[model samples]
Target: MTTAGLSWFTVDAVGAAAPPDTGPLLLDLGDFGSDRTELVGAKAANLARASYAGLPVLPGFVVTTHAAARVRRGEQLPEQALRTRWKQLSGNGTRALIVRSSSVAEDSATSSMAGRFDSVLDVRGWDGFLDAVRQVVGSADAVGSDAPIAVLVQPMSTAQLGGVLFGLDPLTGDRRRLFASVVAGLPEEIVSGAATGTSVVLSRGLGRALETVGPQVPGLTAGLRYRLAALARRTRSVFGSPQDMEWLVDADGVLRLLQSRPVTAAAVPPRHSRPLGTAPIAETFPDALSTLERDLWQRPLDEGIRAALELSGAASRAVLSRPLVHSFGGRLAVDLAAIGAAPGPRRSWLDLIDPRTGLRKLRAAWRIGRLRTAYPMLVEDLVDQVDEQ
Candidate 1:
């Protein structure tokens, strides 16, 4: 079928005719070259390599940058013509398809415009499929410059459990740690950031999966890990920081690479030192009190106690600022002066007393101490002074 003098090539037509090399045009992942098909881009080249490596990739094709450019110049491919082509390509099967934006600038060694494009999933028929392909191709031209898209049509996998995995723990730059979140079904909902429920921590589970699959596939998991780690390492080496990666495991339990990008502000250093001691009393008073000083000290200790408690609270808040999903129902509360701030104090004249209104006095002391510890530098000098005196 032809739309406005441009012939719309169906998968069947391309398959039947088997267009010759036709100059030095890139054929697929196998034919990728830096010079010949720069427009095919890095992402397309990677997908091509993955397919060639005998990976369980869906059978589909790329709609070259050459075709994308034509569409950008107001030469619209008719939905009817595209539908006709799609029906021929899809054949007879209950298949859910995906149309992704494979731009040259997406997976580059340098900068990347990650998550800035559109991809449609679960498309069933030609009409919807063709429209989706065109939308992605067209989006390349809209306001974002001539961002040509290479459309990849892959058969969606029926997954029992799926989610995303990061090569390293984002919270702490701990390389030994691997973080993942598993949902009940296909990875789409999770990828789109719409999934709920607890995201499973994957260090132990992933370790087992890697140990089992690595030797069998030779370079399967190892290669993926190496490549992802290298990508992250190189990115951090260049920018002097770490990166965040996106990955998935299919229904057949084979891992697939989805995306990788630099993690913003993940490399920021900790602002203060961590809290000290365990028991509530120890936390409140790190040093033992002298009898003479204890009798003389009526409200000074309570004031210092309050300061320390406040510091601890502030520290907890700082740790929570970094992006992370804590296990649900985990308690993170800290009250450093709970014991000292109890009611009915002054049983003995020697007993240190704040003489404040109620339990509020004790709670206030605890918060102050927590905050002081939380911002170490801010109060460290003062602590030293008190210690010396």
Candidate 2:
């Protein structure tokens, strides 16, 4: 059985690294890639490639599958080798470490052995470290001898919050949506089915909140939402597939990539399946438009909205790069979700009390201030030109 609440895709060589010839007893996480999965295992290989591609990954080393295979055959662990690496990782002998399993069969495109092995967290001292390694290696017995397991050890992150992000909505298989679930402190509770996390769903293109569940978390800021959306998009671009990513936000608000794999099973909708609405737009047109009218007006309206989205910084260029207005049964409907057009600021005075939305509200206010400044100047120019004409 796969682990609960976590699913991810295997790597597809966005940046192929030649297998490091470094002896396989232990190696840096950056030393493996898709080409070295046999030696390092899928999880370690993915991390190495991601770090190489400039993603924010914690520095660490892997006790390679070669060593794990030997241990599985009832051989002793390379304790001296582990101690040397632990010194290098700990630096001060006080830093706690997290040990995770990276099985050769885990995170595979065909069969994601999601959390099928074991992980140890917040380990301290040599004795604890050795026990943690043994625990991780022993957990591999669940999958038997077929899948050799490598052990990954890294300095534990002092995370303020942690969760998982799906590059696409796993439930709906909607590629245009990003789904995330976050909880306070380490994400082990949420990943292990001990806690129900605050869930957030966003339009992938615009990073606009489509839905949010659970109480408003104090640090779940809109900027974080945008960043998560961008992270999902970038992972897909980097790995050539939609990914299930485990991430953490440290005390400093910096997001770090912890793990990533593909969504082995998901239902992807067709391009035309995007939900369309005619609420405010219907009020203006009210009925199906003639071909001549659609031909005459669609492009201009699309351009106007595109320009407005650009000016507001509410959406990215990629979101606004395409024509958003579409004809359905000769009636024009816009993908407001894609365009990120909302019914103006839905804010109450109570919003001032929440720190989470402060940056977003400030940005909105600043944009409004600029518009206020520019409108008068434009009107003055218009009046002057009218008199001259």
Candidate 3:
């Protein structure tokens, strides 16, 4: 085991000498692979696989599903074993620990139950450790499934920066591009929409940045960019699919792999089957235009829409490159789905009702209020354009 300056060891080292009657209650980080996913759950198993593949994963241990079940049933936990493992992880020093949920349903290949479970961070003292573990284990109830739950415990690193990396473009599902959102502290802020971090786009395999949106973030250096790309490539190679991973940079500038799961939602919807609408576009261009007329009018309309999307940061270049409106028998129909898919400020009432959207609802309402204030000016401009035409 590579401790990386922490006192870490494998479960095999201790389990080999123990009596056969004792089942696996806890396993050290990197000790189990995908085979033990049933016992340790997907989240812990994926982290272990990443560590075994030579990723800079933080040293941690998994309290197995069996142990969590015991806790759930109000059984007396093996206090001695828990204390010994905590000692090894803490290195007998005062350091905060993080206890996170690792249920089988939570980081599966098909669904990533992100932000749905509880994670207790910055834990200290023995009582705090027990409480954090209990909290994580209890969070499994929120899944609404009787799936076995495990708990992952790690000594929280004093990280200078943290963020998430998508091996493929999350918004456009472009496999050749990587999307990164990074912040100065814990990435949970970005996840909760408490902080709108810097968004960066890089070439998937090469990590060469194509564009960056938002302000320049501190500590996101050139070397770190390369390392992040390398990690993405390795994760795809190891997992046989692009992954969505959370990462942190410690005070020493070493990047630590925090979590890894398959990028399930990156699959794009089929383009051919998308239903198109003609209401607004037909109103704009009422008659069937000739080829020359279409050529003259389409460019200006496309340019105008693209300019608005760009100015609002609602759509990506990949989306803008594709034509939003198509002509069938010289009658135009707009790709309404494309506009709806864009990350615009306007959100549906469903967004307001979703508990998961958190602070984003407030942000969206604020943006909508500002847009509403400017609506009259926009209408006046449109009226002037119609009159001139």
Tens digits of per-residue lDDT, candidate 2, 267-359, equal 444433454577748888898989999998788877887767666655545567766788877788886766654322233577557564556
Ranking by TM-score: 3, 2, 1
lDDT of 3 by residue, 1-389 (tens): 22212332323344653222134777888664433777788888888888888888888888888778777766545676778888888775388888988888877666897887789888888888998898888877755668888889998887788899988876556667888999998877787789989999988666787889998998888788888999999999999988999998988888888999998752433333444567767777888888988888777877777766655555555667888778877777765655663322234588568664444445556777899999999999999999999
Write candidate 1's Cα lDDT for 1-389 as tens digits.
34323455433333674222122211334444412234555455555554555433445555566556555654444445344445544663357777777786765535556556778877887667767778877767664756556665556666645555555554444555455555556556766778752343234223423212111222234444444444344434433444444445566666555544444443321333122222544454445545554444424544455444344432223333332211112211223213232111113453335343335446666777776778778688888999999
Which scores better on TM-score, 2 or 3? Answer: 3
How big is the positional error of residue 159 in model 1, measured in Å on the Cα after superposition?
1.7
Best by TM-score: 3
lDDT of 1 at 47: 53
Q: Give TM-scores for every candidate, taking all chains together and pairing residue i with residue i.
A: 0.49, 0.62, 0.67
Give the TM-score comparing model 2 with the true structure, all chains together.
0.62
lDDT of 3 at 305: 72
Error of 2 at 189 (Å): 1.7
lDDT accuracy of residue 172 in candidate 1: 42
Which pairs in model 3 have colliding backbones? none
